[model samples]
Target: MFFAVFLHVLAFAFLVVGRTLAPRNVPLLRRAVGDNSTSSGIASLALDKSSGSYYTVLKAGDSYFRVALDTGSSDLWLISSACTSSQCSKVPKYPLAYKSSTFQAVNNNQTEFSASYGDGTGVSGFVAREMVTVANITLKDQAVGVIDSSNVTLDSDVSGLLGLGFPRLSSMSESVTNSSPFFSQLAQQGKLEYPLFGLSLNRFDNGSLTLGAVDASVVRDVNQISWHPVVEFSPFGMESQESSYLQWVTPLAGFGTNGTTLSPNPSYPEITNNASLALLDVGLNGIYGPYSDVSRLFEAMDGARLVDSEGGLWAVPCDTKQNMTFTFGEQTIVLQPSDYFLGRTSGSPNLCISWPAAQSPSADGVDWHIGTPFLRTVYSVYSYGINNVEAPVIGFYPVTNSTTAQADEENLSSILTTVKFTPPNSLLATPTDTILPYTFNASVAAPTTGLVSTGLATSTYSPIFQAWTTVRSAIPTIAPSYAVFTDSSGAVVTSTPSIAAVTLGSPPGWTGPNGAGRSSPAPIVVTVAILFAALGQWIFCFIV
Candidate 1:
């Protein structure tokens, strides 16, 4: 009997080790395993006071500029001048100022290169780099890819995106050999106190990005557990093996009621499997993972189909309306119907939802991406590691309504209004204007004046033509604006005040400045040009 028991024990040990061991690449079955635990003891420090800036550097012409920083995608690229295509000129262009400075363009004479997004959006540019300065810290000699396009979604405060991730794969990370990733560099230099970063995405400002430390005031317990290096090559191989990280797990008492009580896991009484991991991301705007399992863990009101964009996984439309609840440790969060939809379909009366479904798979198992929807719902913290693995705690704060859905019913708007502008035309000069063709840049701001909600206007009125300027000036609201007007008087009024504010649909009485035509060129200016000296330096680095 004793011998038999020893053999059984040995067999069990082998099973655990075999299950834990995995290949360099992630597996499909492993990622499908149901692991609903939340990683715990991770606290992220808050740095709401700092300004997040996205800077750009051109390679083809050795130019540099600053744009907005977006955490929605994983690519460090720029727009260059060599791209003489009409579309390239329309987007923001980099100035040729590096000719006087010591910069390098390692790539060839090819004026354009292609950078593809998970979405259908792709830009062409040349890859180059130079010493970049951020928060007083200057990195000498870095690699940057410069593309050409004017349709980029950059604002005045937002110049370009600086993706903060592990090294080896990142353009900024691999380019600078001595310098580590942006966040890693800060931690190594002892610039951060807790080795963590925090983010509070608001409707105002450029959404907050805090580096170097976690906000202690926002977290429950600080020294709850010992930190470990982040695990690469997990069950699905979603992470890169470039470095070490940790995932904090906790055993919950149980699933509770009213979002407060914890129940017992009858199958495993003493062992709770609620584990949560720290995700250090800057390119993605939202918290990601399975809606029913990892990340949010909340169920939608209705079942939706899964749609896969070229860039990432998205939710599909479903015929039935549904509702469900998710229990995250002590926190219980609920999602609304509109939160599930990405946009409204023109053919159908319903909206197109945006959520990740379990059906899709990328080259590497089932990939996960945190999009803008998720970002708007959480207050995430990313901690920079100090002394390599010894870092502060990281935290994930769910954006709860604070008050229940019943509390703020009055503030929510059932109808949305947008604005638009039109050129000075006959409608304003002469009355009885009938159906006149109109068009505007929906990618920019909505129209603000001379908007029409219904039929053609008979009265002469001029619509505001500065929708682009007004929308660009909006501080933090992502909801693009629009313009509406009544067609009482109809001559083309390029500039008139007879407009009403509209929430949905096209701006009223407004026409594209270029009129009703598809082939309109965007207006992008290449502020100032100095010289192309950086391109020459970059060539020398590759030759030697």
Candidate 2:
């Protein structure tokens, strides 16, 4: 009995490695990576393809601006051939009439930076600290905003707006002493390996921007990362003086239009039915609320309709083949009626403008805003930790194969609006290639921006600013952040492997996006006695 067949094959190989060991929740980024340390940064991907919007190239000293990467606003500003704002040749200016030696003027006389946007668009620049490179990370001085003047509709591929929110919402000259975005000056000069930053986008534009690491190839399921918790509306937001963590805000948990549940007008205590509180805005490409919760989410989408079109904009209906879910902290995320439909108006192909409406609503306590059509379907994380016991965190990892704008809803081309920023497409990833860590005194390559397909959006009506559109519908479709599932050495498994990770209440439909999930792990039966390991190992191999 060959020792009872090797004790039943070593007890079924330790119960199949303890039942295929699926236990995780690892996101303190592995005890903050030390004993060696590792983090990375190397952005690539730019697509305006007619206003589906998505940008980031940034060079600064030798010309290469495109910028537009907003995590919900902060401040970076470009457009400055000393701004003669004829809307400045459609945008991307800053050559400062030939690199005035990479402009350094931070303040021989500061106080003009007055910028503004949520789409109302405004810019009045003058705040330079320069040097700025990206890819190999180089800040030198940083604080840039030279604009001089503007009307901000943005095109020419896109030439301004980098602001990754918080530095006290830095408005450059909001009275000085404030200003440090661009990853908080790359984590106050230490240059991130731990401060965090990683956005992936796809279906709206190409993707990949990983400063300080997170792009282990755009995570297929870093175990199910969907963390969310960067809240701060402190005494009504912009927390002046002793705490303004400034916006990246979150708290949406509801808003489902094809599977039911669109309720939230309980007389509007700021939309309290499962508690509202949105504003995930990747620098607004639309999706705003409070016109009575976007008019009951377009009347729950059945041949949807909503027109009024003046400045408060709303014209939804170029043919809505409906699909939009969005509920967080139990996770929901789904968007694909061509991701929010923002086109066909100028000559009206029967109309089609549904970004959700807001660039014109007053009583600014904020009602809703989750833009970039739900950030091209997820994989967005933002961190700023290094203190406060490692605070600041926000994640959502669903996008698995998102080649970015996945053929824009079936081979669609572009040409819808402006704010264009063109000039970088070899398929993208240039700074002289090699995702950079440094080495490009001048091979020049950062211009990439050719995908512009969002044509027809020239509106102007102000009888107290109004707007809308509508038609066609459908619903109930999610639970597929694109799926790929890997682990037994195939490498790629993301958030959702937990022994502890479920931070507090989450799990009604998705234990994903990034917090991974809190608990439920109660299954480990392993009862391998096998006749006490084959008669006590054959009486210890015949009593020794």
Candidate 3:
């Protein structure tokens, strides 16, 4: 008890006085990134120690920025010489003002940009054109956001951010009138050998980001790519009542050992959508679902209970033997207990937390987002239609049957090197931060679930404060958008949320120090017989 108290107090001290300074400058990287020898490119991957977010080194014009790749939102933005906010001061910023040759500034009111996230991080800036090098492609005059102000505190950990979402969702979507994003432009220009790419990651060791080609080495059987079409998202929310639409969506055919389909049956529908839809998001870290559906799902496992972490996360007994299997299209995935029991609380018999987060960041309520923990077990190819078979499709292939794989599955780089799209560039791959166990968010909290442009369409703010204010006032009332179900006879039906939707109130805007992949359990103050007992637990938290 004394140990927990002492660390909690120390953590609080760290939060107040411990500020990690970001590297203020790196040379305007005049050199190109990756070898310009091949049609495809490969980037090494790493996870952030503090935030548990993933990022890779990317060269933007004259400088190399460690940028996080986000699939939930669009816009390649970085702190810049123009930013004057406190958040801006801590992140690595490019001297756009001094690097005139590399930074081509665009200053029209229309060119100025802004974005807000569910966690309340917002960046307001102007759009500019600059050369960007990723993998093997040296993209010229790519649109980038030079943040002039921000509410996000990046702790200088990452230098910038890269958006991997659909172009229409880009922060500059209005400026280009919804044109193609940087990667899409590569596809349009035929610079890449293929229209799509694949990312193979491991909990430990290293992973690869294969652009323009799916890394065949990661999958046991490349022929087993189970392709499923993506369902369109319903922005208005009402359209879901008649039909369902969600980003990267697909029908969840059935569940259970007997393969019970989605139905009016209360047991399953309570925690799951009546409609049976699940979205595949690489940006989020765990599978999420509405409160009721997830509650029901856990009920099946003895000792599985919901614990309200900062973002409504769930925890299950570590000894749980429940085998949760999911069906995607024509394929089935059986999850080992390790797949869901992601973290543990300290003690002789540590408490294991489940990997599934039980809430959605959006006002739209909860639905499932298949993220990092789930993807690690399989090989996923997020495909864009260059072959013309379909515009956007998700292909899944099982790659592991391990009961518990705490480390990387295996380095298939050697196998990938043999069949690489083009003789790969000999660019350097740097090692990243150490991956830590779940530590009661003795760290931070985070996620990027969807596009943040709904409220950005019209906003004129003065510096950082007003910019975040405008963003908060703009979040549209969102509720559970759509649902899907599979009938016993194998027929699939999609439906809308039955609850009357209410637009949520304006947000607090840019929750301070937004942590994208970590959890922040709400503070719990427990009392013991002695005052020392309280102090011990508080400080003990920091010990982790």
Candidate 4:
């Protein structure tokens, strides 16, 4: 009896110590399956071959909705059943709020949200609070926009967009005081073990969006990631009293081909000595840069020529072997010919459309929009800082090494048909003609290049021009959008926008900014306490 009583006293003492030692923000225990395996925190993503977009499932209330994961914007919007836009007919729509048991209207459904994108698409809807779930993390009373009208054209597979950008970019910021985005809510509620998330995007297989943790399956080494500070400045060309953190913008230290670094266009002298800023946008299918810079890049490749200046399309010889390189900080990422080359042009089998297209300078003064072509080759991690104590950073882990890229390029070359046609030097000049007309049949089989093929017969313009128009038109623009708000009474509402991680040079450990350790000891202490209590109960029974 005395021994049993002693055990109970010890158990009680342990429980008290455990409670006192527990962290104020206790992290969820890591799954036992693997350190980085898909737990409730990882959402699998499907790539749309046609549009080059990646989407994942978002659980809002009781319904499962397929939404694109867009880092370029900061609004969670879904097409409502009441939407009558022609574009809405092409995609899925969310059921009415009445259908959801957990749905609560924000401001009695008087708050309205509207946004316009760079792709000439826009959405206007009412804001509401709903229980939203992504992967395993659940955000109760999360702000969601139910679109009553929209012109956004999305892949048939996806119904909406889940913006993973900063809250300052949110369209509903003025309407809802608690307008934090889905990911932001996770941080605010201490759902993340770490304040960062990692993306592992695959070209052939389904990728994953890992929340609060890095995906270890794709990352060979933690040391592979080179971290860079996120650009914190006023939106390029916008006048503001103070600088603000906007998109996931980072510096592009250098760009080159075949070990030869290319100089920035002399016209944009700002980027001459300084590194050009690039927005790491997953929503964009291809890489876009200033016209002069893009022109210079293609000009370096053999038999390459500008096809459509307005659409920013270029034709390169199918047999070209030029390798592209991009530098971020001290790390350099290389893309072999197969990685950046699109499929062959229809009728003009000797030439192919390059994945790096041209675009005017972005409103944010960003020089480059690095999209799937660049992202697919690396594992990306975006750190929002731990409890707002650290500065934000973007880390890139090279998934494709030099040897792997070489093998893939060789395989691609083996499957491609050889061509002997030489492109005219005159075609390299940017065309000032009206946008050329081109059409693509949706039912054609994708070439071995894993890209859509053109079905051009013949046209007045060059065969390259005809093929490029269709290909360029198929690629959508996914830059950050402008926000506009309205009231439930259909009156326009105007408001001023209020402006709102990780350790560098450290190996692949749990250390974050300021050497804040990510490892948690609370679980260990709690487990010990539970075991002691269980043992004490057993001892008491044995004594009895």
Using Cα atoms with residue i matched to residue i, what is each candidate's TM-score against the true structure?
Answer: 0.46, 0.27, 0.62, 0.68
Q: Write the per-residue lDDT of candidate 3 for residues 1-544, one digit (tens) a residue.
A: 0001011121111211112221111111121223543266666555543333456666676555666666666578877756778866665565653443666666552477887654435678788777787764677778888778887656534656777766545648557553346775665565654455676765532345667665544654555666665544433322222212224556566443223323212222322334355666555555665445555566566765555433344455454556666676667776655555444433313235555545422322224556666666676666443321223556676766643323221221111111101111232222121222321221111111222322211121111112112122211111112346665678665532232111111112212232121111122221122223322111010112
Per-candidate Cα RMSD to the true structure, in Å, reads: 25.1, 26.9, 21.1, 24.7
Best candidate, TM-score: 4
Across residues 1-544, which tens digit of lDDT does each residue of candidate 4 receive? 0001001121111101001111211112233123432223666665555455667666677555667777887778887767877776555466662356788888788798887654345679899888887765778899999888976655343568788887767768656887788876665555655546777775542567877666665665565567776765432233233344657887777777767777554222232225477888877656777776777787777777886555577887666667888888778888876667755555577676676777665444467778777888898988664321344578888876773235343455543433222334465456422222211221222121111111111111112112112222211111111235665677554422221011111223423332221222122112222323332110000000
When sorted by TM-score, best at the front, the candidate numbers are 4, 3, 1, 2
The runs of at least 3 residues in candidate 4 whose Cα sits more than 4 Å from the true structure, single-residue gaps closed, are 1-40, 235-240, 265-273, 386-388, 403-425, 431-544
lDDT for each of the candidates? 0.30, 0.48, 0.47, 0.57
Q: Write the per-residue lDDT of candidate 2 for residues 235-291, one digit (tens) a residue.
A: 233323232345666666577666765644322232222345566666454566555
Candidate 4 global TM-score: 0.68
Candidate 2 similarity to native, TM-score = 0.27
